[model samples]
Target: MAAREYGQYCGVTQALELVGERWALLIVRDLLVGPRRYGELAEGLPRIPSNILAARLKELQAAGILRRAPRSRVVVYELTPYGRELEPVVLALGAWGFKAMGDPRDEQVVTPDSMTMALRTAFRPAVAAELPATSYAARLGAAELLVRVDGARLDVSRGDGPVDLSFAAGPGIRRLISGELAPDRAISTGVVEVLHGRGDLLARFATTFHLAA
Candidate 1:
């Protein structure tokens, strides 16, 4: 007598039925960044109707995938420790989705906070074993991006100064960070414009990580 089942398949289908919805995975992505208020969640994913988001949250809570935090005046959602394990799985799925599908975009609106949060979950440090002594800049939107890949570490900054290569990137920054499009293809095709420095530096820098999802 489980609560969720599309039919009598009753195995993994039960779990899938519980979590499978158009936007369910995104809800988990939002929580992976940090706890968020109901309004905050709405902000992360603007395309989801408020009512639908509410129902999805409730369904996930019932499935033991999410839990509600005690709020004095505002409602907040936090991932249960159980729910946090989903981070890697979702990242891997996203990685595969990007490799299979390439650049992610929909009419669906996604917030900067949510996008940055999602990017961080699958962060690829620009280097494999040692971070570079020199930093790099990428320009996106009105923001000047600062990226430092020191060996195993990544430090991102914001400014329009010379450090290393400069990139004129767009939303596909997600795909680049996830390592879906080979950096070579991305630059050569102008999907990502490297304005300065050595493209080989980035290619060398990009070899460290694979999107495990």
Candidate 2:
């Protein structure tokens, strides 16, 4: 699986050689959230060619980054302990790229897994440590997420649950996350719709999940 050799005896070169193939790190990103069946991965990455997905999966498995294992009697792909070490790297990279993300393209669609990772990337544990615990039921594009911030810990998952705030946002939500739009301005400007909770909590949400531009 070391097909993309750089002829350099360096760790960064080796790392890229293992996962530099297009769509490889994305597969790792999705699995970092949780185990996913093959079909689930396909669903998350709608644009990935089927053959490419299969080939990358095989390559990653060969690299010992991920493994297929039984989950509820069905096989699912999950990152190994070694692969789990990539979490911080992925999150840091996401934060770095986020600074340059001005707006979404016409064809770009947010997936649950991607949204989950985005939340994780922008989470401010130190800020949340000073704020009261809060839970949010957030709908971003087509992704529905339950986000809970308890002091310094943040938890996110799919589906709805008891939440202190519920809101829906579109791609413009990035403006709020980037602190370009204030919470009050976001709600008043129709960038965010308060569905079923105190709108004030949206301010808390903004503070807790923020990535400075």
Candidate 3:
């Protein structure tokens, strides 16, 4: 089916014409972190049908938002520079929507990319500035994320690296960052494990990322 358009002349409308389709922006969200193979994209967006996902990928590529390139003998999808420009827009949207979030619903799923994006959106620069430079490796289920804090900036990337802290991502970590679960309680419940860092560094990590209530 042809993509539906608003048939309007406004720039917002034009932009929406390119990305307003169902599953379009979510695909963009997955690509924002880095390039992904077709299978990886499918894993990230479990609900999107394969046919629909392929169509959306084609549409996005044709719109100059993303491109397919060969990587190590396999084709992977990555955002074009133009598509990367949407990073701030997506992060801002995530922050804005976060204010209205309540408890997670039973049917809701959280992908690693989405969780990483949340961390990106929740970084507190002032808090980071007060803390020493640190690196962390977080195992969120099967996904491993490397997070580095330098001065007032926080960067999160996929995969592990040498770091000051390592912890499993679970309710405890979530609660700790949200300021609901106490650090001691998180440790006691095995929700968080300090694998390679001082307690104080873990405390600093907790303070650096906070979800707005």
Estimated TM-score per prediction?
0.65, 0.97, 0.85
Candidate 2 local lDDT, residue 143: 98
**Reference-based TM-score, model 2:** 0.97
- Reference-based lDDT, residue 69, model 1: 84
Whole-model lDDT per candidate:
0.68, 0.94, 0.84
Highest TM-score among the candidates is held by which one?
2
Q: In candidate 3, what are the lDDT values of residues 1-213, reduced to their tens digit?
A: 344977678989988888889999989998988899999999999889999999999999999999999999999999999999989988898878876777567776778888788788878989899888999888765567899999898888877688988877554456777778777777777878777776556677778888755
Say which prediction, candidate 1 or candidate 2, comes out ahead on TM-score. Answer: 2
Worst 10 residues of 3 by lDDT: 169-178
Q: What ranges in model 2 sit over 4 Å off?
A: 1-3
23 Cα displacement, candidate 1 (Å) = 1.6
Which tens-of-lDDT digit does each residue in 1-213 have in candidate 1?
Answer: 654446666666765786678788889887886778988888778778989999999989988888888788766899988888887877777666655544445564545444444445445554455544556676654446566666767555444565667767676655566666778888887777887897766665345434542
In candidate 3, how many Å is residue 121 off?
Answer: 1.2
Candidate 3 whole-model C-alpha lDDT, 0 to 1: 0.84
lDDT-better candidate, 2 vs 3:
2
Q: List ranges where model 1 is wrong by over 4 Å.
A: 1-4, 7-11, 70-74, 102-110, 117-127, 133-167, 171-201, 208-213
